[model samples]
Target: MRVHKLTFAALAVAASLPLAACQSSGGGKGQSDPSSAAASTAPSPSDSKASDAKSPAGQGTAAATGSPANGKVDKCRTDELEITAKDNTIDGDPDGTVAVQLKNRGSRDCTMSGYAGVDLKTNSGPVSAKRSGEQAGPAVLKPGKSVAFGINYPVNNSGGSGVRITGLLVTPPDETKSVTLDWPGAATLPVTESPGTPVKVGPIGSAGQGG
Candidate 1:
């Protein structure tokens, strides 16, 4: 009887061994989930930084295209002049001061004289205003290069309604090769003189306030 009992005990112990091995091999309740483990490791700082950099605010497109200091003229057609207006400030009068930036993204350099000043068109006709700087061109802007024209005027009598800059004329110094610049529309920027203000207008040719 004793010998038979000992053999039975050994057989029971052997059966339990397989159960232990199965549990160790992920067949048990405490088995690890691979995906959850990876998430817990956390992402690196570099990865987080890259995501933030792609944001629009970081790229400086919060309002318009191009640099914040300058206004960008969009969709300039071939053979037509392009002007982008920026930094508009209207004081007590509707007509204040503004900076008109011009660019010659064309193949050939734009050699012109007497570029047209900004005009406020109304029902009667085009209301002509004077810019402090010279319209005289020959301001030779190479391909992809840009030049700015500083203009200051009273916001008063700027057409009781909306106004368009209309067009620009490029009269070359050598010959009368004139190029008509089509207006892409107008951008109304707030007028402010404070350091933190978006639009600032000061003296001409004072390190960026140039025409």
Candidate 2:
């Protein structure tokens, strides 16, 4: 009977050992799952620093390109310009050209563009002058610099009507007042009795050899 009691006690202790081992393994698995979840939720330090570095460079580039709100400049004034005419008469040609030079006499920079209004004047009244149909772009004139234009017309070779031109009446672009430049040397301008006659005037360009 004692031997049977010892055998029963050993069986009970052996079953209890497996149950204790199972409880220990379950607690270990639960702790390992929570540790893995914490590692996945945390943010990386390297990724946060890289995002901060790129923001300032983009903002700096935008500020550099956007200065100067208004884009247009001021127009040129007439009183600041000095006007003169140069004789460019070629030999044996009926068509002649007079180069009109305009110098910027002001202290500041200005702009000049388009055709200059020109007319020939005699003792009686103004003669007819046609525009040369030359297109001009805007030209920026620095202080003391000059720009030129050409006045083209026919020479008076006919002996029928003796018309004399004493001076030139020049009007700058977008100006109300006119400037009168005297005829250089013995230069004579062609004259016609008809009204509204055309005188060819070229666009503003670089200063030529004469005037």
Using TM-score as the measure, which candidate wins? 2
lDDT of 1 at 59: 62
Candidate 1 lDDT, 1-211, residue by residue in tens: 9999999999999999998888787564586688888887878788778788788566677556544454333333334445565544543545455556656668765454443434543333444444344334245566776656555543324344433344534332233344554433343323334343222222222214222
Worst 10 residues of 2 by lDDT: 202-211
Tens-place lDDT per residue, model 2, 72-106, is 55556778898988787677766777788888888
Candidate 1 least-lDDT 10 residues: 198-207
lDDT of 2: 0.75
Clashes of each: 11, 6
